[model samples]
Target: GDQSWTCFLSADNFKGPIAYYIPETWSKIGKLFNYPFLYGRGLDARPGIMGGGAMEINTVPCFEATDAQGRVYSRIPKLQFPVDAQGRAYLVQDVAYYSKAALYDAVKSWRDGGPACSGRFNENGCFKPKLNTRTTRYSQAGKRIAGVERFFDTRIFEGNVWGLQWFTNDRSETGVFPRYFKDEGEERVVAAEAEVPAETNLLVQNFKLAKQGAPYTSPTVGAWANPGPKLGPFNVKLADGSVVTYSWYRFIDQPSFQQYRWSEEKKAKLQAFVEKLHASWSIDRDYMPPPTRGRLVALDPALLVTPPKGLEVGYVPIVTGQAAQ
Candidate 1:
């Protein structure tokens, strides 16, 4: 219940224009246009790093099917992530969840064509009309949607960022994580402002996993901090003076790992892989393709732990913040 779940899609392997679609009814001008259609375009692809280079960007809309009345089924249901114009569903490429059941439901929903329409602009995104039933089946889409099940085997590291933990129990699907970690928790009442040693590199520890350099935290720390049940609830002050609360969980014992049909082999393998990641992957390391432009940032800055007094390097302290009293 500590962290927020995010679904990040990559266009690296996408053959052509990278884009996503939304029903016309949902777009700002959908009603004005009066049609059954999809409004989508190749989202502008910016360089991962600043001033990287120029790249092709595309913007295209879709109007596949219309009714006898010359009206398109424009009011079709909202869709989930990884959907295509043909009505095929796909799994999130890089995602983080609070628990295995949550992960399982996400995958199952995609496999089952998801809800016909879970309502517009809802959490899980919108549900698309299955245009290509032949290929929409799990058997057909499974290979393309591969690796989602693999998450079932990995340990979930959970935590709340800037007090956004509400999403974990938030059934409304309206909760969202803050874009920037500002030191406004005191005013927000989600978290109380706290302090660490004046010399504590809060920026580095807070953004420790970020790929961007100075002013931002380095990806690699001098050594790994300890992880434990008693770890955080720690208040982190970022370079911009925003305070964020972070918490960490033991790799395996974290609640999300509990409900699965995992084998000892798979668990051990994943554990070993995590160890390897800790040892070799620097906070600034480019494990995945670096975006062509714009500086890279951490997937979740909360992953790193700044150990409290007397703790040694091998231990990565779990981080969390104290709630406002």
Candidate 2:
């Protein structure tokens, strides 16, 4: 089945500062697999409908998860974390597609109302009442344009303080993983650190396996000077019968930066900055404003965490990618 190949589509007019699959393509892929986990990104150089028709959209039997809850949390055992037959796990772009769809649907509903205005606008005294009137086009361009605006509403870009996206001196960071949640309602739980292979790191091990002998430098995962308040001990059992462990670390506290080649002084400075944030910011408070147009899904109460002591809360982080991060 071409299910082994995965493809991404991005467009300028489309939603988000993030990449989004065009509606037609998303519908096609959705029909193939409600929660599809492909082995690799097809063949890199091949070019066609889907990277040179690598996807067997019609013939492959659609795969489904047995767990009722597992269906919504697509990044769990069956979908996002699967190890291919070759024993490789690729980095997943852990966005909650279901939540994304819900956002799309909300915009559609709003547009169906046939609103006159395209988006939220401010007037400096010369406002007309007809500007807020309903029109049939709202179901068409109104919805489409509104959806695009809703997607990029967040401050999830570099240089923004307290948004989903963050940036360092060298790079910009985003995507779901190392998410925080309440102990009882946490969307997904991973393995304990002790269960995984102590000698081999998951990021490094998986990086080499995925690279398949390509000439690439091994990446590093750094450690925090004062590791505090985290969740996990959650585990993912690989196809090779090995288990990998992960946890939910604060956005800044996560080991993502360590994967790069940075000077010790730089690392220490970042860690110090993280420590300062940890002391000041509570995870429970909302740093970014709520979405004005469409409903933002997956900010579930069940997934709510009672910020432990000094720690507080913010965005509902859902990891849609592989554990290699």
Candidate 3:
């Protein structure tokens, strides 16, 4: 079997961003892949199409912010957090493909003032501005763009914001792999293409043929159970026809914690408190605290002072010598 490499395609006029992979390198791979069909279906029937060579397209909405001064800023929404193979986290922005100047102007428009105008028309019937607020306008898709729940936060850039294609978000999920849910009224997962890699790798890495004398236990009940040693090595074929072998025991336990045993009501309260604390911080402030005197000085909200039943909270406050007076 010939190996195939999956590739993603993006264009402004695409109804759903189309993706196709090169199943056979020689069968019009270069021509079909590089065809410039701006606003029409492409390669409907082509040779060497493996499994139809077409994939489900995922769309991300593009946004434009305009001010009363006729200045406009545009951006394509992006995912902030995506982890790598080695478990290192990195910030990832969806493909913007905007020129440096355009990106900077867009960010600047959102930061200085929003896209709304606060002034009234003058005697000449010309629109005059007492103030200009940048207003956001979405593409034809309306509010829900790219599965993003909220509009882009200009404050994420802080004061030193630039036109670069990269940024960060504190609200992003912590792992490289995202969690998926079953589709409504369907037992199958919604995004099989995205989940297949993670699910397959997880099964390969965790398959245990024998049970240990005692299952590894954690301090908290209902934590993930460790099923001792794995049976043997697992092999997966890569896109380039390379078979990579992975041993189960080679996978080490990454740092993790079980949720504190709290009632649903208490958990809701704690979540609300944390949200409020986050809101209290200045938007421009980075979520990560700067180290002071070789110590990380983090704010522990007063709501966390009392522990829930069967749980305890601990911290040591770093006091400055000057504050002692």
> What is each predicted model's overall lDDT from 0 to 1?
0.29, 0.29, 0.28
Model 3, 76-184: lDDT tens per residue?
3333443344333322212122222322233234334544221111223222222212222222233222322222221212222211121233323434122222222
lDDT of 1 by residue, 191-230 (tens): 1113222232221233123343333221222222322343
- lDDT for 150 (candidate 3): 28
Best by TM-score: 1
lDDT of 3 at 120: 16
In candidate 1, position 231 carries an lDDT of 57
Better of 1 and 3 by lDDT: 1
For residues 68-98, what per-residue lDDT tens digits would candidate 2 score against the true structure? Answer: 3322111111112323343222321112212
For model 3, how many clashes? 10
**Can you tell me which runs of candidate 1 are displaced by over 4 Å?**
1-233, 238-247, 261-265, 291-325
Cα lDDT of candidate 1 equals 0.29
Candidates by TM-score, descending order: 1, 2, 3
Q: Pick the lDDT winner.
A: 1
